[model samples]
Target chain A: MIRFDKISWSAGSFALEEVSFAVPAGSYAVLMGRSGSGKTSLLEILCGLRTPSSGSLWIGDNEITSLSPGERGIGYVPQDGALFPTMTVRENIGFAQRIRGEPAAATKATVGSLAERLGIGAVLDRRPQNLSGGERQRVALGRALASRPQVLVLDEPLSALDEELREGLARLLKDIQRDLKLTTLHVTHHRQEAAQLADHVLRLENGAVVRESGPPQNG
Target chain B: MTLRGSRWFWGLLAGITGAYLAFILAMLAATAVYSAPSDLWKALQSREIQHSIWLSLCTCTVTALLSLFIAIPSGYVLSRATFPGKSWVQAALDIPIVLPPMVMGLALLILFQTWFGRLLEKAVALTYTVNGVVLAQLVIGAAFAIRTMHGTFDHLSARPEEVAMTLGCSRARAAWLVTLPAARRGIFAAGTVAWARSMGEFGPILVFAGATRMKTEVLPTTVWLELSVGNLEAAVAVSLLMVVFAMIILVAVRRVGERV
Candidate 1:
């Protein structure tokens, strides 16, 4: 579960004012807003990439406001996938484990398994530059799940893909969330995606949550 | 006819420039080969020449390593963070590069001869010593390194380091593992240029370290010394050696830069 209570942050003229939301455990929550609605900012705040001026953030039982991004146990995949171009897909996927001092052999096994599950086993040796848009997204998703965090925060993950690829990945994401029972907070402006994938929806305007819909897809 | 004429004109222009570049290269090659076997060999066997070459290599290697160690962090901070006086710091880093080498040496000598010199001499000697040569080379070489690395760090987005940090690596660790690896080619090129600059340094070594045979003498200083003593053969040999080393380093840097 994830909860934000009265989170406020100011960057120059842009401000996230009194924002709040809650996502239940093992559910997909999509946040929809136009550009400059602080949707990315909210996700960044939850991921601990940006600090809120005031308010509390809770991931499960832990108050994550004081924690660093890594300590928050939240996997954040940015808009562009942000995969290291120099690293092979296998290496990129295993980066979180490598950072945490996991043994090389163990990391290899884990990454191999994740790649197989993501159907990216064949491209494991290739670099991110060589991967197609959908393939990159899958590799990025695999990388995020490598650490097995409490929640996954995806910021416009499907926005960069073409129409055909985005639709396929959207369904794939829903399937992954259901199969893994992973709690996910997906940020996007695409209402159709929200309609299809989200268990619930929160609309943001001027940095504040203005509306909430319950289990849109489940109904 | 018009299209063919334009194409011919462009091709001719390219060919002319290529021929001029090839002519300069041929001259350098001829000078190296002609100086190598007899004059260069005899100079290489001399104790003074051997000592100067050794000193040059040792000082250049140390300067290159030290400059890289310092430049990496400096470049990262300048590239990644915003702080007060950032522009001033950047401008200061470039000062040594633009200063004339002889002026740099003179300034170093004057600073060392003042109260600063006495203070440093108390701790460790500076003026007219091997350390002085190393210090001069370091000052110039580090500037070259920082300039190269600053461009490199600027070219890279900070996203990789940020991602590494989110993956449980500390800031320093992220810099080491991700940022440095991403800029590896740039770093290598910087080190090569720094070492080459140090090896070819003449004015700074002569002014600060005083061209002492078998003591503080480096390759360029040895060439200068041989010329002063009317040993034209030995001077030509040392110059040829320095030119060869510089060419090798430059070629390697170009190859690495292309790959990166």
Candidate 2:
């Protein structure tokens, strides 16, 4: 479970005040907001990228407001995939393991399994620059999942795709979320995506969570 | 019509610039061939010329490598960090580029004459030594390298390093693993440029290191030494050697810059 209690952040002319919410364990939550509404800021705060001006965050039993992103056990996929342009898909997926000095064989196994699960095994040798939009997103997903974190945070992973590709990846994401039972916080502006994939939805306006909804109907 | 007027006008301007470069290259080649192969071969075999060539190669290599060691972290911080007096620091870095080489050498010589230099000289002498030559070359070479590296890191996104940090690497570790590898092309370009600049450095070495034969006689000073002695053939030969060395380095720089 991920919970934010009375979270507030202020910078320059923008402020997000008393934004409180929770995602039950093993459920997928979508955060919807217009541009400049602080949805990305909220997600950033949760993943330890940005510290709240005043507030506390808890992931399951751990109070993560004091922890670094690496210590918080959160996997984040930023907008545009942000895959390391110089690394092959396999190296990108295996990066966390490599940094931690894991054995080469072990790192390879982890990368192989993640690539297979993400259906990106065929393109493991290719660099991020060579991959298509969908392929790049999938490679990014495999990289994030390689570390096996409890929370998966995605920032508009499908916003750049075509309508047909978006629908396909959305279904694939929902299926993967269910299969892994990950506590996920997905950010997007598209309500149709929220209705399609979210077990719960929260809409933010001007830095506040203005609405919350129960799970969407089964397909 | 545009200020540039037409394609023909631009082509003519470009052709003039290209002709000037061709003329300079032809002049160097003509001078080199003015003397017979036997004369060039005899000049090359001179013990002083050989020693000067060897000294130039060693001192410039040392200076370039030392400059890179300082440039990498200095460039990264200058490019990526925001701090008090950032503009002041950047202005200080530009001094070597803007300062006259003779003035820089005079400054170095004065520094070595100070109490601090007197203390240092007790243990290891710097003035008029081969080590002084390396120091003189490093002063300008490192400044150029730092400029290139700073530009390189500025162009690279901070997102990759942030992502690496999220993946459990500390900030330094993230930079080492991801940022440095991604910046390989920039590193190569900086190193090559610094090496070439060090090889061509003259004024500072002449003033600080002093052109003592077989001691501080680098390729450039060798040409100077030959000219003062009225050995026109020897001076031309050294000049030709410098041209050849510069040509090789420029070619390497071009290849690396393309990749970057």
Candidate 3:
């Protein structure tokens, strides 16, 4: 489980006050908020991209507040995918493994299997610039999973996709989550996406969680 | 003729200007090439000339590498972090670029003649040595590298490095593996420019290292020495060599820039 307690942070004119939440293991939680509602900030803090002014974060049995981002074992996928343009898709997927000092042969096999499962095997040689929005998102998802993270945090992963692509990608994401059985925190303002993908929903307004909805199936 | 004729005339005029500029550049290239071969042979055979060229290349390469090593972290910090006096730090990094080279050399000389130089000299002599030439080049070359790299890092989104960090790479490792690869072309271009800047450095070497022939004498200093002794051919030879190296660097930078 991933938990944030009494998190407070101020960035310029924006402030997040007393934000608290927990995402249970093997559950998909969606953070729903309008633009400028501090969703991105919350996501950043959770992923260790930014620190809370005051708060405690816990992942599993570990208090992650004192740990660096690298030590937190959280997988983050930014809104734009943020794929390294210089690296081929295969290399991009295997990046985290390389960082963790995984054997090159093992990394290659792992990336190949992931890419095949993600349906990006054909474009493994291409760079991010050549990949479509849907394809790039898949590669990003594959990269995050390659690390076998404790909690996967995705920031607006579908915002850049077209209507035709978003629905299919959402389903793909659900299937992947189920297959990996990984706890996931997905941030998006889209109500449809939140309703479709999340097991539970936390609605943010001006940086505070105003409403916490029960599991989507219960609703 | 209609309005279209006037537009065509403007286009023709622009083309003519471009042609003229190209012609002038070609002429300069021709002059350098014409003087290079014969003079270069004589200079190359001379032990003094060989030593100066070797020293210049070695010092500049070391300076470029050191400058890049330091500049990468500094540039990333300036680009990605928000700290007190960040703007002031940026301004300080850029100060050397706009300052006249002679002024930079003078400042170095002053610092060397004072407590800092004595401290370094106590461990290893800095002034009037090969090391001094390398140090002088690094000071200026690193400024150039940082200025170029700062923009490169700034233009890139920090999301990739953040992703890397979250995946268990430390800040330094994330930068080296993720951020550095993303900005590889920019860093390469910056290194090229820094190497060229170090190679052509005259003012700093002249003041700090005192232009000792075959010892601290870099290519530019050798050129100056040749010119002072009425050896125009030898002077032009060294200048032409510098120009060739500069051209190679420029082409390489252009190619890398295009790729990025």
DockQ comparisons of all candidates to the true complex = 0.60, 0.63, 0.71
Error of 2 at B200 (Å): 1.0
| Predicted candidate 3 versus true structure: per-residue lDDT over B1-260, tens digit per residue | 68899999999999999999999799767767766576667866778888998998899899999999988888888898889998888899888888888888889999978887789789988899998999889889999999888899999988888888888888888787778888888788788878999998999889988899878999999999998998877877777778778888888778767876
Best of the candidates, DockQ: 3
Interface RMSD for candidates 1 onward, in order: 1.2, 1.2, 1.2
The better candidate by TM-score, 1 or 2, is 2
Candidate 2 regions off by >4 Å? A6-20, A103-105, A215-219, B1-6, B9-13, B16-20, B256-260
What TM-score is obtained for chain B in each of the predicted models?
Answer: 0.89, 0.93, 0.88
Error in Å for residue A70 of model 2: 1.4
Single-chain TM-score of chain A, each candidate: 0.95, 0.94, 0.95
Put down candidate 1 lDDT per residue, B1-260, tens digits, no spaces: 99999999999999999999999899788777766486679888999998988899999999999989878888878888888899999999988889999989998988887887789888988788888889989889999999888888999877767777778878888788877888999899889878998998888778888888788999988888888889888988888888878888888888877887
- On TM-score, the leading prediction is 2
Global lDDT of each model?
A: 0.87, 0.88, 0.86
Where model 3 places Cα greater than 4 Å from the true spot, the runs are: A23-25, A59-62, A97-113, A179-181, A212-219, B1-47, B255-260
Steric clashes per prediction: 0, 0, 0
